[model samples]
Target: MRLIFGLLYTLFFLGCLTTALFVVFHLLRYSLDRKVAVFGTVFFLSVFVILLFTNALIFFTLPLESLFPTFNTL
Candidate 1:
């Protein structure tokens, strides 16, 4: 039970961190580009929206029972 919850918590935090780092990488790269591609902005925004929604869903929909069988109250 503890191990399952631990793994889920780890994955949730790591996913959020990874998405944040990806956005930061894109921002830094775009800043460095002298002739930033026009479509890059659109693409970046699309990806950001997608990732944000995905993370939100993951965080909200995670099955507590799978992680903590004892706390299946919910």
Candidate 2:
């Protein structure tokens, strides 16, 4: 069904995006602080959740009609 596909896509994309953000944050935090890194960890997790939620909301509302126009015609 359309609803299931939409949900699955949204969840998959959100997970990837969140993981990417977390990895980048981890790298940056390590560079900035070699010791006492819990603050960075907490910040990374909080931001990840917020951004993931926001991205999911946007993806869920996106119109399916807007996809594929940029593909090269073969």
Candidate 3:
């Protein structure tokens, strides 16, 4: 069902965000060079955001009903 797929996608999206946060936190907390830490965080976050947004865009555009037309039928 569309609703189930939507829920799963939401969970996946949240998981990605949470994973990014942990990565950023570790980069900032464990790195020896402050400049490298900051740069790495910025670059990673930028790419991650762009990719995540693109993923969401593509996901929203998928024809779920057409893909799962028989899901609701007996």
Candidate 4:
């Protein structure tokens, strides 16, 4: 169960990164104005990175052992 959640979390992060890449691609590829594209890319990336970092910090600090405690079995 513990390993399951960890794998899911990693998959979620990768999914977010993949989605962000598409967004960035569109922003750069379809924009009429170069300055707008550049600014949007910078702002979007900055916020995305900050949120991703903060989420990782919080998730790692969670008391997973207590949340998903293991037990001895016969």
Candidate 5:
């Protein structure tokens, strides 16, 4: 059902976002070069945020029927 799918989708997004955050935290905590760590964390977090937004946008805008025609029968 759509509800289940939506829940799973949200959880997946959150999981990925959290993973990205963890990576950023580790980079900032462990990296030797301060400038590189800051820059890398910013760049990586920006890319991850952009990707998450794009995916959520596409997921909401895309027609489920087009993606799975057979589901229409249900």
Candidate 6:
């Protein structure tokens, strides 16, 4: 059970990273102004990365027992 959850978490994190990369790629490829494109991509990616990390931290730190005590029986 723990292994499955770990695998799922890893996959989720990788998926987010892949999505951020795709967004950056599209921004750089489609934008007309080179400077603006680079700046936008960097700013967006940085904010995204920060938010992702914060979410992961919260997920891991959260006390699940308080929210779902029944799961402890399983």
TM-score of each: 0.43, 0.47, 0.91, 0.86, 0.85, 0.78
**lDDT of each structure?**
0.68, 0.68, 0.95, 0.88, 0.88, 0.85
- Model 4 vs. true fold: TM: 0.86
TM-score of 5: 0.85
Once superposed on the true structure, which residue ranges of model 4 sit more than 4 Å away at CA?
70-74
Candidate 2's displacement at residue 36, Å, is 2.5
Candidate 4, position 19, lDDT: 97
Model 5, 1-74: lDDT tens digits are 56767999989998998999899999999999999999999999888889999999988887777788887678
The sequence of per-residue lDDT tens digits that candidate 6 reaches over residues 1-74 is: 44555588889999999998899999999999999999999899889989999988987876777776776678
Give the lDDT of residue 24 in candidate 6. 92
Give the poorly placed runs of model 6, Cα more than 4 Å off. Answer: 1-5
Residue-level lDDT of model 1, residues 1-74, one tens digit each, is: 44556688678767876876677667657666644643565577678769877876775676766766767553
Q: Candidate 1 vs candidate 2: which has greater TM-score?
A: 2
Rate residue 62 of model 2 by lDDT: 66
Best by TM-score: 3
Candidate structures ordered by TM-score, highest first: 3, 4, 5, 6, 2, 1
Per-residue lDDT tens digits for candidate 3, residues 22-70, read 9999999999999999999999999999999999999999997788789
* Total clashes for model 2: 0
Better of 1 and 3 by lDDT: 3
Model 1: how far residue 17 lies from native, Å: 1.0
Tens digit per residue, CA lDDT, model 4, 8-67: 889999999999999999999999999999999999999999999999888878787776
After superposition, the stretches of candidate 2 with alpha carbons farther than 4 Å from their true spots are: 1-11, 14-35, 66-74
Which of 1 and 2 is ahead in lDDT?
2
Candidate with better TM-score, 1 vs 5: 5
